[model samples]
Target: MENAVLLNAIIENAIDGIITIDDRGLVESINPAACSLFGYTPGEVIGKNISFLMPPPDRTHHDEYIQRYQHTGVPHIIGIGREVKGLRKDGSVFPFMLGVSEVTLSGRKIYAGFIHDLSQQKRAEEQLKDYATHLEEIVDERTFSLQESVEALQNAKEEVSLSLEKEKELSQLKSRFVSMASHEFRTPLSAIQLSASLIDKYAQPFKSEHIAKHVGKIKNAVGNLTTILNDFLSLEKLEAGRVEPSFAPFDLVKLSEEITEEMQMVAKQNQHIIYQHTGKESVVTLDQNLLKNCIFNLIANAIKYSGENTFIEFNTEITGNAITIVVKDNGIGIPEKDQKHLFEPFFRAHNTGSIPGTGLGLNIVARYTHLMNGSVDFKSIVNQGTSFTILFKRHE
Candidate 1:
């Protein structure tokens, strides 16, 4: 009597729902928890088929399953736990875990089942999935923002590097300009002063030839100053983006002759300029003023570098859309080492010892040729001679 009372107390207080069914699948008893779990009264479930608490197709197949298990003595869900849906008294359904076991009293067999609601567990799992998805989205957004920031920083670094390079180049140009000005200006200014004093001394005696000689020296000195100023001005215009080519049709032969004629006054003693033209066409379209400056620089350089009695050849050739100008001089040529820097501003050849020049002639010529869409090249042999060629496309 005491053992039976203890068993009844345990079944009544158990947290999980408890159910007992006969071998024929009839519900014989239900604990209070089982009644509340399925929204049923013990009187309503007792003596009813156990399939009443199960939702179909479990309800439809429950009786057949029990008959097969009883005949074969094989367990499908008898000793194992599984999840299944239960039908409530109000016809509502919910998930639950079930475990069944078989017991015998006398010749009668009974099945007991334990049940637990799984609603809370299912809700928690769904929340975990949502949280993971939101985290991944936040990480992707931050990674994209970081990539953009890196690219912007890279562009800023490149801009800073380019600015520094330009600053360095400007600094070097300024240093070269200052040195050239001091060296180039002092020589001509000193010559003009000396020549003026000598002219004053000869003025008291009034010798025509002597006074005329010093006056001629002053003129040449002034011309040298003009050339130097022009070079500086052209360089400034180029750097300031102010020089643009203005093309027009003109006679190549006439232009060459005119330039040669102007250079004769400054030529060395007994020196002569020989001009020649090849191809039928002597007329071409080009930036005349720029081309004239280029030719004048070449011819003047030839006269300045060569000795007395040397011949300077000026030749022009026109073929289809191309024009070529050659200036060949029989003079002390540039050394092999100095040829590479021939077009650099303020650069002078080592072989030009004591020569009176500002070292800007070739550099200015090169700039002028570029403005006119042309190229200048030269070949030189030490102590032998030098030749310069200018090639360009005809403007029209």
Candidate 2:
């Protein structure tokens, strides 16, 4: 009996909670660890009914379950660790794991059980589940915002393309209007000039100052009309791609001198002109009329914008493999803000509002320069002067 008591003492002090019940469902023995697991002291739970540790429905049904199991000796979850719930002495419930084993002693049945508390583990798992839900929500919100930003960018690009198409249509419309205006105004002005000439001619030689005055007005109007018409025709041909390049050997020197001489008459009212050739007499391959037009137009523009008697310089030089001609003037220069638009069709300087112009001269000259495989560049200082440099390939 002493040996049996000592062995029972050894099993009761184990770290793992231990308990045994008879096949009749009565508490046979229990350990100190089992007592601590259920909030009880040793001997306080030893012979108590095992149903005392189960909750309401389970407590009432446990005896019937044991009776059924003893009759059949069939197995369910016994002899295996399984998660379950346990009721404490204070009526608080906690999660636990349970395992049971059955044995035969003296041809009678016995049972043993192990129990583990899981309150802390349950709390940790709940916290992890909450964090996962929050992370999923954050990812969903950012993905939605990114989709909105992409949609906005696509919309902006479409708007820009539509605006560009409208601008192209407006440019073509303006060109048509200018062409129509030139045709409409030129016919009436031509009739008036012929009438004035006939009156000056075969109608008796009147020393009448009034006749001379009237004829002068007719001539002035005709000249102004012609200038406008010429500008219109040139701009139209340039824009329509009618100007073709015909390269041949030509006298750049004589062409330069002739252009300057004609432009000198036009410049007489505003500026003085000087033309100089600074290199060996050289012949270059280029279209004579186109090159002449370029020089004449440059001189005409310089003489128009400068102050009275301002000196205009026309210079030509043969440098390396190119012929460089420069047209410079001491005039009211273009503003910095307007420089970027200088070569654009119909772009004029702000200060030249009172000056007579069609606003397409530089654009034409630039196109002709490019067609001849050359480059045109200019420098201007406001209220000071402007100079344009034309570089043409000077081939032998």
Candidate 3:
């Protein structure tokens, strides 16, 4: 009685579905779990063929398989386990694992089969596959976004670097302007004051030569002031885009001669400007005023920077399509490091010590040359000399 009660309790509480079949493949008994698993009750399933719980093919061949097994005394599914489709009471099919074992009681053989549903495990596998695909897509999107952010940061960095360079240039220009005004203006102003005082002191005798000497000194001071003012005005006009070229045909040789003569008055003591003309053609069509300013600035620089008794060569050459102007001076040549920035506004060489200059001469010359559609190039050696060559295309 106790063994019977234990077996009934074990079958009733088992997690897997359980069923018992006779040798004829007929269902003899089923547990409550089996009834719920197949959507059936114990009374409805008892005395029915076990084939009724399997879908077609398996249901049709089940009886033939049992008969073959009994006649041949061979086991096919009687002691083996496999996965197969099961049909529910509602006629829906699902996957389940079936394990069958043979049992003998009172010289009659029966089979007990255990069934495990695979639906939840299959669903969990599908969910894991879907999550893996979703993760890959998210990673790809983030990688693309990160690349775009890096490119944007690089562009922003370049823009900031350009802005800093421009700010540094402007600050240096301001410093040059302040230094130029104080040093350049003081020299001429002091000379003019001293000359005027001397002229007044020697005025009583009315000595013409002494008075003339003082007058010459005053004139030179006035000329220096005028040159500084002109440099400032030209730079302002150039920066404001207000200086326009007026083109005309002019004799290059005559222009060079006139400028050289004018520059001689301001030349250092015992220094002279030698004018030379070469090539066949002398006339060219260009902006004469702008060209004049360019030539004068070069010659004036040559005169100012050279030592006393040095000769400045002002040479000009004209060809069929081009005109070249050369100004060579025996002066304190520009340092190699300062040559690169020589044409920049307000830039002065480190070697120009105690030289009264606004540092705008070469910058203005470059601007004027550019306006005339010309190019200027120079070669210099420290303590030896400096030579500048300007070339212009002859406009037909």
Candidate 4:
């Protein structure tokens, strides 16, 4: 009884299911572990067939298997370990690792079986796999979001860079204006002062040849300073949006003619002026000073670029409701590349070799023309000639 009690204790404490089937394939004994594993009691399963513990098609074929084992004595089914399914008392099926061994003792043939449940292990492995997949998804989403943020930052940086470039350009323009005004103004003012002093001292007779020469020098110096001052003041007014036009009836032909004469006198020895007025003598409402400055700059540029004997053609005409003035010079015309930057402040053409200029004349002309609600156009050839046209609204 002590030995039987010890066996019962071990059977009850065993963690693995143990069972035995007789040669007839009927369950002969089952341990408490088996009872717990398949939800069967010793009393209920002892007299029952072992096929009840097998699921599906295998359950129905168990008797044939046992009959074949008895006749042929095959060891394949009697003592083999494999993965198979089991049927519980509750009619549910689950996976298990089954081990079988044949035994013959006490003149009774039997099969001992061991079973290991696989459900819990399968579930744990699946849970870990799901966790890894979820982590990978989270990482991919974060990477995409980070990329979008970087692109946005790069675009913002590019926009900031472009705005900085524009600010730098405007600042450089201001610096150039200051430098040109100081140097260009002082030299002309000094010449005007020197000429006035010499005339004051040597004017014993009003008809002196030296008096004429000094007087001419003083006049030229004053003219240069006046032109420089006009450009600076006009540009300032334009930038401030305060260039209001003083409209009045004025002679446009006379302004053009006088500017042409002045330009011809300033040109080199070989350059001459040919100016004509084709429009009717009609009065126009405009700012006379602003219009005269524009015309003078245009004509002066024409003569400045031409050879000594080259003739500059100045033509004026009325077309529809607009007045057109064209100035053409047969001199060293501007290159195609330099024409694009013609109106930019302080930008001189690359081909302008040692020409004495502040490079602000065309810029001033463009600003004043825009203020007058007019437009200027030009065409140039390298060594042939250049032509400038201005179109203004006609009014009286």
Best by TM-score: 2
Query: Order the candidates by TM-score, highest first — what do you get?
Result: 2, 1, 3, 4
Candidate 4 lDDT by residue in tens digits, 86-191: 8999998888788898888898677888887887877765665564455345434543543443344334334443454575565455446546655755575566
Off by over 4 Å in 3: 1-205, 208-218
- After aligning candidate 1 to the native by TM-score, how far in Å is the CA of 119 from where it should be? 99
lDDT by residue for model 2 (240-296), tens:
778998999877788788787877876656567899997786577887778777887
Model 1 residue 20 distance off true place after TM-score fit, in angstroms: 99
Tens digit of per-residue lDDT, candidate 3, span 168-231 = 5644553464366447655755665675566556554544453455355454545555566567
* Candidate 1 C-alpha error for residue 218, in Å: 2.1
1 or 2, greater by TM-score? 2
Query: What lDDT tens digits, residue by residue, belong to model 1 across residues 1-396?
Result: 999999999999999899998877889999999999999999999999999889989999988888887889764577646989899999988888899988888887788999888767777656655644553454345435434433443343344435545755664554465356557655755665575566556455534453455455455555555566567557656765788999898999888888888888778899999999999989888889998988888998899889999899999999998999999998999999999999986677988886656577898889888888899999999888999999998644
- Give the 10-residue window scoring lowest on summed lDDT in candidate 3: 149-158
Per-candidate Cα lDDT values, in order, are: 0.78, 0.74, 0.78, 0.72
Q: What TM-score quantifies how close candidate 3 is to the native fold?
A: 0.49
Distance from true position, residue 299, model 4, in Å?
1.0
Candidates 2 and 4 compared by TM-score, better number: 2
Residue 35, candidate 3: C-alpha displacement in angstroms: 99
